[model samples]
Target: MLVASLTAVGAQEGPSGITQRTVFAPFDPTQRGCHKPPGLTKELAYVQENEREFLQGVNHGLEMAAKDRGLKYLRSVAENNVPKAVEDINAYQAAKVGALVATSSDPTAVSSSLQRTIWSGAFVGTIVPPPATLLLNAPQYATGKALADASINYIKSQLGGKAKVVLLTQDTMEYLTPRFEAMRDAFAKTPGVTIVADIAPTPVNKEGGFVTMSTVLLANPDIDVVLGGDAVVLGALKALRVAGKDRPNQFLGGIDGEPEAVSEIKKGNSPFKASISLSSPVFGYAMGQFAADWLDGKSIPQAMDILPIALTSENMAQYEADLENPAAVYADPIRKSTYLKMYGNICYDTRDQYVNFPWSSESSK
Candidate 1:
């Protein structure tokens, strides 16, 4: 039996005119990786660690937001694994519970199991960054591609419409290959963007630095921009700096941000031009608010799973403030308060909500 408490706080009109309810749930991460394989490469390990930190930060931000609003909240006081998540959902469904949130990465698995569950709606939040395939498969890649194109165009405008470029990425990132391939194809068609060297490392381990930097310098000495995926590239940048190869005038950019990367920029010594950040705090808070509204018998638009906004260096300061104080991030405190009310004392539960799939008995079969 899952024991939880619910406290209700009043609602307020959101900027979209939707009455927002606050729901606070204690979040846990220990049980989310039941099926995760061991011995991941350094790049994958970095991504996982960064993702965990991002989620924890978002949760802390939400807690602050909840306290500011004095809304009702729920707290879960149990710890369970992925399989246990399925059991909990099944039990809830058997009791004809009105609404519930379960976490899992396989949406198809969740949908298959919970198609007839008691909940009127459900939402899935991934602890992992979207796979390269998922990102490239969507129209969003067009946006990323366009951003890359614009960067190249800016370089062209400065260097007279033709420049030699080297694309560097860790070889183990199989998923990003498609997107990089798309980028290569796009660059091929552009007037002045020449692919001087497209190099990949052997295994994407700590040695990725030696392999990538050596290859870039040897194969493409005059390379202008170094386009890479994430932390691996950051590592390569550090290696370049250590070797006294990183030039301030050259351009360096990639997808995600890390502390080291920020430090590099702050020093004003590295070639890092810009980084792409998907604000996890905003995404998590939005998910929490949506869950609260759904539980409160409110209507959610079919387009609720819209892509989150991208953060660039220009507007990153505003999000940095939001990360520090979520209450100030959104204008509608009442709606946020209403959302917090849904979670009651369940905030104490540290169980991973994302490991379980479909809340139906048939899922066990």
Candidate 2:
């Protein structure tokens, strides 16, 4: 029998005010893995570091999960290197680690290697981008649309539906491209919304965003809106301030509710407005729990969703509260439900159900 920790979170509400995108698969927690538990020297390796506060949350979740499972934990940073990610997995495999958690590592790049890890008899869990024993994702289209709706509302209510916009994107990510595309679609329908520049920075960081926006400012000096990941958008905020373009009418927003973005939103008058945050720590902890489950020969969810919440000054406090104490917040029937969606189970007997490519929770919807 599966023991209930706290209480079962029924259907939870996401930032979109609908069902929170959290999903998981049913597992018999009472079971244990076929492989012998790792000896004293072995560890459970977390494949990559998710940088920034968002990923810091993930790191903490993994840590908390490790502590809860009483597993020696190891972590390495790939810094986005596919080969390094694979090597790290192999290193853990060689050590005969009981399980692995790959956080936001490229699924396409690491799919073959992850599959091999499973073949080597190790349990795996993946987040955001995945193809592992356990997977979590938000519906990309919905993710994009949610952010677009936020921007559209701001454009109409604040900017009067007329503004010069700059879109900084990690366009190389196929799943995330919809965010930019949705913004474009919304802008197309609204008159007086001119896209000043839509560009991808080389490094996809704050500095890169600053450099790119500085150049874009050379021609489009009147940019009043900016959209993209928080790192890039925050960089653009710096550029706009230096250029003396951070005006009251200007609006800025992005996904990945970095702390900086939240601070900006709290400013009340700053152009930095909204962010779509997937509570990495909360979901990461859930992922860790799932990882522990998989290692114990328990069935695990093949896929789940960490739904994004659009954070503004108004809702920042409550969200922060949830983040600060994810366990307590998740203990709540409602919030917990949003973060824990269960699907069909996967066990050693169902290893074929282990995902090895880009899997979408939307498919099960």
What would the per-residue lDDT of candidate 1 be over residues 235-281, giving only the tens digit for each residue?
A: 56766666677677666666544445545555655677655444445
lDDT of 2: 0.71
TM-score of each: 0.56, 0.83
Candidate 2 residue spans exceeding 4 A from truth: 1-43, 80-83, 103-109, 339-342, 363-365
Distance (Å) between predicted and true CA of 337, model 1?
Answer: 21
Query: What's model 2's lDDT at 166?
Result: 91
True-structure Cα RMSD, model 1: 13.7
Q: What is the C-alpha local distance difference test score of each model?
A: 0.42, 0.71
Q: Could you report the Cα RMSD, in angstroms, for every candidate shown?
A: 13.7, 8.6
Residues 1-365, candidate 2, lDDT per residue (tens digit)? Answer: 21111111122211111123333445444554443323313356787744667777877777787778777778888877777887777666656676788754566666655555555556677765555667777666566667777877878897777778898988888767766777788778878788889889878989998999999999999887898889999999999999997797678888878888888899898988888888877877777776676566566666677777888888888888877767665457688666556554665445555665556666445
lDDT of 1 at 163: 67
In model 1, the runs with Cα more than 4 Å from the true position are 1-123, 126-139, 157-160, 168-182, 199-216, 302-314, 332-365
